[model samples]
Target chain A: MRVRKLIYLLWATAVFLAACGGSGKMEVTNAWGRTSPAAAANGAFYMTITNNTGQDDKLLSASAAACATVELHEMYMRENDVMGMRQVPDGYIPLPKGQTVELKVGGLHVMCINKQQEFMIGDTIPLTLQFEKAGTMEVTAEIRDSAEMPANMPGMQHGGG
Target chain B: MKQLLPLFAFLLLLLAACQSEPKYYGTLWPNPQEVADFTLTGTAGPVSLSDYAGKVVLLYFGYTFCPDVCPGTLADLGYVVRELGRDADKVQVLMITVDPERDTPEQLAEYMSHFHPSFVGLSGTEAEIAAIAAEYGVFYQRHEGTAATGYLVDHTARVFVIDQQGKYWLSFPFGMMREQMKADLQNVLRRG
Candidate 1:
């Protein structure tokens, strides 16, 4: 228990510094993919991207062996009382210097199309995200029943637009 | 300021969360229309809206193949119902598949089991679904996508609530918080 608390304390501090330090690093955290039932044709992943690279960066695309095709998708209110989802028109997500972006449920997400197999809880989806300047970042997203709710940490919550 | 007094009282009542004719967070119809009873194939065979009479019925137009939005809504509803405990029995969540060809009864049932056992998924012929969807102001159309996805359907994502008397009561927009949903449901039950 003490060890866990210490780890939390360390994590809390790291998160705090990331927000205030403006460290020249590209970091991705809280990456998770939603579990897919047997009949589901695709899956989705959400995460938080903290880009303190001191320069603008763009997330171009993502690829994974778990899925044949991956696309950056956005869900929006299309018309009167309707929600519509479409691939990002720009085909990339802009990460301004020192800004944190949250890919959340019912909002911006990574669409994993043509699921090779059903994803169950505890399974991990290894991803290679291509970036404009940050090169490629390898992220392992755990399959979870639901995305984690944005905690009370600073710079963690957004309108999911 | 005579009108202002009533408005002030209404705001106070809302803040107090009084049981006396509480206004729900969902969108209420100016004129509540009675919903047409429709039958669809459920896990236990043909199920009709009237079969769930005397309960607050939430009709969601979606399919099992949906990855982000539908699952988010289902997960939120599951959380809401679970929070209600035994009182959840008075509420029914029905996900009517817009992708009938893909969402067979058995497949939908399996998907709902992942969220909450009490929730039911229903599917029917394309004609049958289109008719029911039209009656409720839901519009859906299939659009071409990648070969892997077969196709994608763009449909209304609102959740329509049917009162115990089978009238269109209120509609919850997508991305509504679970707490708001729970409160609205409790208020409906209380008023009933």
Candidate 2:
């Protein structure tokens, strides 16, 4: 009976990991980048990072050959009704154990500054993300336009899409 | 149980009625009040708020150098104006730059054209712009940046809507969806 119980627990753990799309130490999914608007030189990239490991992980930095520089930044609402954005000063994004962090539009994102090439639709942007515990993981973010962005984020109520 | 069914139906109807009330995504002002008139330099020449007396004006505050929020707001406005279709003719978009020191009238105009050909960009002296912003309750402050990253400005992001009668009608918060804006604009056009 004890062996059977242990087997059941292991199966349940597998099911939970599968449900969360977490395979190993860290899983990055739904990675995408936005094409710059007309005449704009800079663009942004977004993705979801799920920490599946037992230990907490920190995203130290990111790099891409497509841009001169890549920085982790956050878009936050400031006082006096201002919308503010700046590079994360500490230079690391935290991913706690078993937590999923989303880097999306109008929130946390990767700033692709002074691009060497244009980010067009259907293009795949190769990015190397460095994590403290998980080490370096390469990701490819699909380039999409603003119209293709999902509006289902909480508190986003725009009509006439 | 049979009698309770009517009570439940009545309660559901009341809930539906409450939800049916015309909902506005933006902050609804109590009444339409005269917008503080101001004159600023446009691409062509001097422009005044009163010049758009018969049109609905959507005003946004930001700079051309803003990579994210400003552009996002402009894109939202473009979506709104384009969604309005023919009624778009009656709607005007004006982007007032907070960084007038660098954003000349010509630069503002050129940037506005990239978003929408009909969009107008306005700029003025630092004091002039400050006065206008203060009157509209917009607070802005500059944040210095390193050599690689240029300086940034933190300013109000709400879109103020001026009705056709040239009165301040409503103020839409940042992230207010395009569909709600379209509906409000349609209602305004219909009323006009």
Two-chain DockQ for model 1: 0.23
Supply candidate 2's per-residue lDDT for A99. 97
Q: Which stretches of model 2 miss by more than 4 angstroms?
A: A1-25, A38-41, A115-125, A143-161, B1-22
| True-vs-predicted CA distance for residue B173, candidate 1, Å | 0.9
For residues A93-156, write the lDDT of model 1, one tens digit per residue: 9999889998988678999887888888899889999999989999999988766543322222
Residue-wise C-alpha lDDT for candidate 2, range B1-192, written one tens digit per residue: 999999999999999997563556677766668888899999789999998889999998988766666766777787789988888889999989998987888878877776678999999999999998887789888887534456767788888888888888577777667787788888777667
Candidate 1: where is the Cα deviation over 4 Å?
A1-23, A117-124, A147-161, B1-20
Q: Clash pairs of candidate 2?
A: A157-B177, A158-B177, A158-B178, A158-B179, A159-B178, A159-B179, A160-B179
Which candidate tops TM-score? 1
Checking candidate 1 for backbone clashes, the offending pairs are none
